[model samples]
Target: MTLTEKQERALCVLDDLIDEGIDVTNLRQEIHLSNTYSYDAVRTRLRRAFGSVENALRAYGLYDQTAEPERLELERCFYIDQDYRVSENRYKSEELKELYGISEIKFQQYKKVLLENLEREALDIYVRDTFPYGLKRDYIYKHKLWHVEKYLRNFYGHSVRKLCEEWDFSYELFNDSYSSFYITQGHIFEGLVGEVLDAIYPGRVESQRRIENCIPDFIVNGRHWIDAKLSEKTAFNRASKTFSKYLKHTENLTIIYAQKSDGVYSFPNVTLVHISRYIPELIKIHRSDLIEKINAFLSNLKINIENVS
Candidate 1:
């Protein structure tokens, strides 16, 4: 059960980074490894180290506490590093793909591994109230993609470019890789909204359709245009800037956002009634009453219809 020199080194670096609240995306660049360590090499060493630890714990009847080796590795590799750019919910970084030989099939396997042994209660504690921070505690209580919430807060708290500079990663490259993750989140948000709409009026929701030069997210009853905005506060300014292009003066458009923010959005010359609310509210009432409320809400917005036809 003796730890390999590389395993010991990786763990040491990992602990240091966690203590410092440093993001672990560019660990290889941030810390110098005596030996050349590729993504695969580090992963292999971590796996072996985890097995060693688990075996030692088992010798003392503590194996059950350490039964989740794969999950433990993810906590060390992803959570401890606090790197939200790529995690279970996001697309893996290219370097990670190359390091782990992750194909489409392997990606699913990797996801399965990280998802095992995760407890929502622990994650709730980690986010709702500050507990003594430790990877061991996070592993015991991780909510799915807790890192994303952390990253959003970090990115909003300061300039993303400046933070990326600290890690020697290109901000543009990081954003590009992260756009997929962002888009995936958007899709999930939109899907929830769509379900609510469909329940009200079946077969009336048109999605991802191009009208004129703009493709709107949803068109209800061949008249009402709706766009769902589900973004962190950090991306609000950027998202607001692009709102005008899709929303014309003549378009019957309404925008619904997931979160309420004290920050104001600078809308274009166009006048529109945009509501800041989430799906939970929409799903709270009886289906018949919910439908009436949704229609009433959209009607109150007084959207202007564009003659795209």
Candidate 2:
């Protein structure tokens, strides 16, 4: 895909910032401040075009770097100070202060430095165990590692891009996985919808039956088209336009959304329904065992699907 001129400019700015050793966790604000684009605009454009700001930086051959000595220092400090093993002891800050015979202010400063190194050490161990050869940025986000990302940024002042660089990983090889993750997730949700539909309309549900240029997710009773979306309706306008082509084949089109929206989405010959609401109701009566499967799927996605009533 070719990037627009503005997107190209944003990538250039991001390239310069990474070279200057800027922390990119707050990349949207950084890019917005560096250019005429608003924060939301920059964020939306980058995400729409590059999947993420990190991926945009990767597109420009930019990745974060940390000095080898700094990592070694963190590891040394963590190992040398046995008391820094706060996770095992579960000591309160006050208890630690008293044990060390220090004022609260001094204890706070001491704890800050200790935890910084400790977090880095823990993160390193986690990366080594979980990703052996290299950490995949898309895997982190897909698995909902927000806490890990936040901890690394807040305590270690490092981003996933930095870890990738440190591990000698190539972003070019895995950056595309960011977009593919969403596509995979969407396909999973679509399959879940198809299963639910199969239980409801048994033997009447057809999968990905093509009609002209459009291939809807499912066709029920050889008439209605069912399309499962794993995102909010506000983000479905592009898909909706494409689905409009299916109207020529079938007047009935059901758009099932995995995520709930506050307002109803409207389109010609299309009926919008949330998966959480519609699927559970059908599954409760048609196939209760599917509840376990649905919940397991949601748990893996780190999301909640309402129980069947």
Candidate 3:
């Protein structure tokens, strides 16, 4: 670990080649042109190993390279990558395309120079006594549905890291048995099944995590999961027998009950479906029962009968 301490030995082999998936443009070509040293001395030792920890393990990536105990997973990525959003830049998107805007004493002298640069960076003395909780713009959409464990990614992962962003020592191996619909209609049931279950399962539903063991409310497609209950009627009969231990992982569950008397009841292999009976012709009867199981697996694949000759 010491070619004159080559920036903490290339940040511990660039965090074990970014947990062995490698690809920060092949990790700057395997730390500068695969080893005979001197791609300008491995880019001056990876620019002083991302300038002495400002890269923080390439901004925190290497999460559990598949130890896979009790499904605690993590591989965070947030790439929108290309968007200068081509506009009249040079701030205020070029003062709204060079019409020279923002009067009212130049918007109170640019909000008094951004509160005097957050009171000379003490950030108002570390936000005075910090009263922040929930909805600070919803912690960027629950950390983008917890690094995309969307279709409920078999519920609860990031298996161990006692402290990444505060709490992550999570593990819940099995639980499944589902039926639920207890909404008073919020965001019109996520604007008609949340953009058609993230356009039919792009990495499976995760409305974020929380587990006293299962029912992390909202999942679909990557083998359908859901647990939403708005309460009352003796707390929806003790939360429908407490998600009957989510039938040990997956029974393609749902339990959406918003019945203030009338309409919406769909029960297939389980029962009680009503966010007003999950409308739009009961959500096209689940894409016409998955096009009748892909037309009964192409009518039992008769192998086109050509061999009958």
Candidate 4:
């Protein structure tokens, strides 16, 4: 029951607020700013503070019971952050003047669009932080393993030479050929799978090391062996037969085909999956239960509030 990063951050903010004598239950009405700032800046500061508290409350399910007037005011204040600000060019555009002509309708439309974008951006950030399975892509969202070596370097905090030393290896191998690229691609795909699995089912994914003989890419829950195939042609390759033999004794095994191709293929008596399909499915499931998950996350934080009233 690990607290999500958002919950941890929100808890810290709540602790600060409570330490400052701000009432958590009546956050919007009770928060008070110092007289040091100008009137406008003070108002802005108060709004920003209230917005943060409102976010924390919402994360904890406390804000769901907020009064209508307070909730609406908090929502308005929440949008004042720099991320919600329109670009200067957009502000000066002729379309802006036309939009302003129909102020009431345009305001509602603009708010909707802005809030939707903000929510999407926040979700994306959270997903990345929660499951940093690295995949490079072009303008379109396609899994490209171009950043494989880079990710490995960063994740392991070592270069190839350093890795060899850390692992107590005597020799090192290097080649810029397709074979080397293929190996790196395989590692990247397996890493992505491991990250996603770990996010959904934390502390269950364990990557197979280079020295591990006859091991699959990952072992989930110490039972299911997950093999990542980055190349479509690998299915037909003789090496795949050897891989199959390694996992033959295992009761449950899954093959993750992580190539960029579109079509699907089935394997004999084996679970076959494509990365493109796999990632989106996991994202959909996560999004479907996101609110309940966040609430669970808050409960895990164990924030002791002595003075909510």
How would you encode candidate 2's per-residue C-alpha lDDT over 1-309 as one tens digit per residue? 477887787776555544444434566446544534455765676677688866775555334322222333322323312211225232444444344343333333444666764655555445533542224456557866655666557743655665556554334434455534545676798889888888878899988665533457799999988878765552354444455557878889888776665665576667777666655677568666777767676676654323210
Off by over 4 Å in 4: 1-177, 209-213, 260-266, 284-309
Q: What lDDT score goes with residue 20 in model 4?
A: 57
Q: Candidate 3, residues 1-309: lDDT per residue as tens digits?
A: 124455557766554543444433344465443434434554466667666333534333332122321211100111111110111114542333223332222323343444332222222111111112111225425645332222112222321221112221111101111111111132333344544445456577776343323434576654567654321231233233344445446677776533232333333344445444434543554665534433342343223212221
Candidate 1 vs 2: which has more TM-score: 2
User: Per-prediction count of colliding residue pairs?
Assistant: 7, 0, 29, 0
Using lDDT as the measure, which candidate wins? 2
Estimate the lDDT of model 3.
0.36
lDDT of 1 by residue, 208-233 (tens): 77654345677888877776764224
lDDT of each: 0.45, 0.57, 0.36, 0.45
* Candidate 4: clashing pairs of residues: none
Error of 2 at 95 (Å): 91
Candidates' TM-scores? 0.31, 0.39, 0.22, 0.32
After TM-score superposition, the amount by which residue 211's alpha carbon in candidate 2 deviates from its true location, in angstroms, is 1.2
Candidate 2 residues lying further than 4 Å off, grouped into runs, are: 1-174, 261-264, 279-286, 302-309
Compare candidates 2 and 3 on TM-score and give the better one.
2
- At residue 50, what lDDT does model 2 achieve? 82
- Model 2 C-alpha lDDT versus the unseen true structure: 0.57
